[model samples]
Target: MTMGLPHGLDGTVEGREYLTFRIAQEEYGIDILKVREIRRYEAPTRIARTPAFIKGVVNLRGTIVPIVDLRMKLHQDCRPVYSEFTVVVILNLLDRVVGIVVDSVSDVLRLSDEQISDVPEFEGAIEVDSIEGLGTVGDRMLILLDIEKLMSNVDMGLVAADA
Candidate 1:
C-alpha cells in the first residue's frame, strides 16, 4: 500500500498500510510494499571506510545486504542494545535490497489521507524532503517517511547514483 505520496497528492493515499517502527522515542513508518522482511538484529560484517551509520553488510541467502542504523543516521541518542525486540527491516528499494536497524517494530497501521498531514518545510539532520508526512492514530503520531527517497539519496549510498 502507498505510504507517503507527495504532499500535494489528490487524496489518493487513503487506506494505505504502513509498517511502523520505533527509533528512540519517536515512531516512524514505511510503506509496507517496500518491506521485504523483518529479521532479528545481527552484527554484520564490518566494512572499512563506510560511514559510521552504515552498520556494514550481511549475507542473506547469498545476497549481500547493507545495513543502516536508523537511529544513528538520524543522530538519536537512544541506546542501541540489540535484543529480541531489535530488528532489521529489509526493504526492496528500486530493485536493490537494503536493511535498516530499528529499535522495535510496532504494527501494520492503515491510515487514511485525512490522518496524514504535510510536514512544514524546514531543514534538519535528515532531509525534510525525505519525510512524507505526519500520521495520527489515537494518541500516537507516526512520522511517515519516503523510504525510497531517503534511501536513494546521496548520503544513503545504497541505491545507484541515478536511481
Candidate 2:
C-alpha cells in the first residue's frame, strides 16, 4: 500500500522514506509522500481573529499557505522560538499545500513494517486519533502521524479562506 505524491514523487525515497521531526521532546514522523519540503523557521503574516493554534500564513514560492503551530495544536505550553526551535514542514494533502510549524526537524528515517507498532491506548492530552502508530528506533520511539486524518480533521475551508 504505497501512496503517491501529486508530482509522481514516490512516497518512499531511497535511504529514507519517512520525514522525521520533533515536537517538544517527542519524535514524530509522516510519510514523505505528504511532505513537499522543509524550510527554516519564518515569521508568518498574522491573521487576526483566527484560532491561536493557527500561527498564520506564509508565502511559499508565490503560494499562500497556512501555518499551524504544532506545539499549540498539541496543547503544549508555548515558548519563544530559538535559532533551532522552529521549522516549517510543507505538506501536500488532497492536492492542497500547507505548512506546519514544528519544534525542530530531526532526520529522515527508514523503518520496516515490522518495526512499526500500533499505539497502545493511553490517556493523555495528545489526540490518539491523529497517531498512525509508534515506530521504534534503537532507544527512541517515533510517533507515526496520520497525516490524512490530521489534515481532514480540520476544516480546510476555514483555514484556506481565512488564516
Candidate 3:
C-alpha cells in the first residue's frame, strides 16, 4: 500500500509514515520521505581518516554515497557482523544522499499524533534531540528518529555546517 503525508485543512500535519528497521535488538524508524531506496549490503571501498562506523563509500549509479553502519553509529554494537540479512537504507536528506547499514528493513508504518509520545529524559551516546518521539503500535514501541538532525550533528560530519 502507498502512504503519503496528510495535512489538515488548517495546514497542520495529521500523521506521518516511517520506514522501520532493526539495529541489533532495537527497532528504529525514520521519516519515510527521507528514504530513497533499500539495497542489499555490500562491502564499500575503504577510506582513510574516517571513523570506524563509516564503512566507506559506494558508487551508486555513478554517485559516491558514504555508508554509515547504523549499529556502530548508534553504539548498539562496536562491531557488527554483516550477515545475509544486512541491508543499506539510502536516505536523501537536506539534498544529500547517504546510506545507513541496518540489520534488516522492517515495514513502513503510518503513525498518528495520538500514537506518538514525547521522549523522556535520558543520558546516552545518542543525543535526545535526535529522537523525534516514541511510537506505539499494538505491543511494539518504536524509536522515531529525526535522521536529518542526527546526520547533521557536528560529530556525524555528514552534512555542511550551514545545513
Candidate 4:
C-alpha cells in the first residue's frame, strides 16, 4: 500500500524563506513574509532631532513610514548613491509597517533546513546577536536576520507609537 501522500509532494522546501539585500559589500536576508514591498530609492521627508541612522519618513501610498539607512546601522562607510545602487525594502513589524533603506536588493531565495547553519560567534568586531542563521547558496553566503529582534531593539524603537 502507498504510504499517504509523502511529505512536500508539491516540491516544497521546508524551512524559512528570505529576501536578500546588500548593505555595503555584505549580503543580508530577512524573512520574506515581513517584507511588504520593494521600491526604488526616493528622497524622504527630513525629520529633525532624530537619530543619525534614521533617514526620515517617506510617503508610501499615503502612509508615512520611517526609513532607516542600513549602511549607517551597520556602521559601514557611506557611499554616494548612484542610479541603480539604491533601494528601499518595506517591512511589517509588530503590526507597524516601516521602510528600510539598503544599498541594493539581490533576490528572493528559499533556504531549506539543510542549507542553513548556525551563526558563528564573532568577537567585538561583529555582533551576531541580530542574526538568525547563515545560508549558503552556491558560492555566496546570506546572513539571515532576525526581524523581530532587529525591530524591537531599544535603539531601533520601530514599535514606539506617538505618545
Q: Cα deviation in Å at residue 34, candidate 1?
A: 0.2
RMSD of each: 4.8, 6.4, 3.2, 4.6
On TM-score, the candidate that comes out on top is 3
Pairs clashing within candidate 2: none
Model 2 per-residue lDDT at 37: 92
Q: What ranges in model 2 sit over 4 Å off?
A: 1-16, 155-163
Tens-digit lDDT string for candidate 1 (48-100):
99888889999999999999998888874544678789999999999999999
Q: Top lDDT: which candidate number?
A: 3
Instruction: Provide the clashing-pair count of each candidate structure.
Output: 0, 0, 0, 0
The all-Cα superposition gives candidate 3 an RMSD in Å to the true structure of: 3.2
What digit string (tens of lDDT, one per residue) describes model 4 on residues 7-126?
A: 376655466668999887789999999999999988888899887778899988888999888777766456536367789889988888888888899998877777789987776323
Q: Count steric clashes of candidate 3.
A: 0
TM-score to true structure, per model: 0.87, 0.80, 0.90, 0.85
- Angstrom error of the Cα, residue 148, model 4: value is 2.3
Best-first order by lDDT = 3, 1, 4, 2
Give me candidate 1's TM-score against the actual structure.
Answer: 0.87
Indicate the worst ten consecutive residues by lDDT in candidate 3. 1-10
